[model samples]
Target: RLFAEKITGTRRDRPELARLLDHLRSGDVVTVTRLDRLARSTCDLLDIAEQIQAAGAGLRSLAEPWADTTSPAGRMVLTVFAGIAEFERSLIIDRTRSGRQAAKAKGVKFGPPPTLTPEQITHARALVDQEGRTVKEAAALLGVHRSTLYRAFNKQEPTP
Candidate 1:
């Protein structure tokens, strides 16, 4: 039986992979094009291997001779690769988090900038509240959308 999943291997619950696991039987060999295609993490790979073994089945990787779970040496090599994959994943996560922290420390802001300036918002609020100008009129005069002006005006309100 052949099962295919387009989901990333890093995800824990890939539907096709789960189906394949469920359908596995004794002596069945689950084959993949590559070890990376099967799992992105060592723990996940090891867990899947254990599950296959429990089902009296084995796993094979077409690209990696060392990924044959039916042989002792292949299992050992796969174990080593799993450790390396986990270490590599940890290093990548650390680098990404550090880069984000550095960017934040440097005052780098994410997402779109405010649509209206502080002065423009103050003027819009005054036109709407003090002069009793409609939101549409204030927004048209300030060259902004009525919804944008409305949101800004609501946020700027003083508590009673």
Candidate 2:
């Protein structure tokens, strides 16, 4: 049984997964604890299963209890489930993309708004003019990073 590196948190062993794939032969079986443990997403699960089948190996999901490809019923169920999983993944991707597009159309900011408010920018720039303090001194007084002050007032906005 081959476990994914992402779960174990030891990424240097990914090449070991490649080696396991290379060593597969006919009638070999790969087992997993659970479907999600084997793969975080449906696309990832289907992709790994396809790779195993291509290498002349079969997959057995312990939690699924009926995914063994050696049996006729198991093979039938696998074909149907693989199709279902792929469809489910595509649906999720489409939904996520649509949601993001809708948010953008509504003018909802994708990330945090400008770190400093417009009022703060004016005050900071004034301090820079009146007292001749360094940007870092004004930023320290404002309780923000020096880079935040620079990004808010010193840097020019990009032109469309």
Candidate 3:
């Protein structure tokens, strides 16, 4: 049996998992302590399990007590649990949507703050115009990137 015991915060990145995954073959059984230990996100959990199943292996969560791909009953139970998890995720999404709507009604804009100030923009433009530096060089002097300079100049062109 593949024993997946609880991993601590220190091991959350799980550098060793790739090695285990690379070695796992068809008809192999992967056992883990719990679903939470299996994945930090529901989507990730499903993705990992899908990868295992695609390899012709099965996953068993010891803590879940019913997650077994080896038998029909186990598969049925897992399906029900997956449905429940999906429903829960949907509910969260709906609530988030409503909350965002309410926030938008209040004129709340959610996202990162603007990186450059008006003064910085004017300075960058002045430097580019006065200095013999190219756009890339100007961006380098300003500690930004060429893409940033292009955006500031409104020179967006579709890249192939």
How many residue pairs collide in each prediction?
Answer: 0, 0, 1
Worst 10 residues of 3 by lDDT: 1-10
What are the models' TM-scores? 0.54, 0.54, 0.61
C-alpha lDDT of all candidate models, in order: 0.85, 0.76, 0.73
**Candidate 3: residue 13 lDDT (0-100):** 62
- The CA-based lDDT of model 2 is what? 0.76
Q: Candidate 1's residue-wise lDDT over 25-88, tens digit each?
A: 9999999998778877667788788899899999999998878988899878877876887889
Model 2 TM-score on a 0 to 1 scale? 0.54
**Model 1: per-residue Cα lDDT at residue 114:** 88
Tens-place lDDT per residue, model 3, 42-149, is 666766777787888888878887777767787787677678889998999999999999999999989977566666666777677777568888788778888877
Top TM-score model: 3
**After superposing candidate 1, which stretches have Cα over 4 Å from the reference?**
2-22, 33-57, 131-160
Kindly report which residue stretches of model 3 are placed more than 4 angstroms away from their true locations once superposed. 1-12, 115-160
True-vs-predicted CA distance for residue 158, candidate 3, Å: 23
Best by lDDT: 1
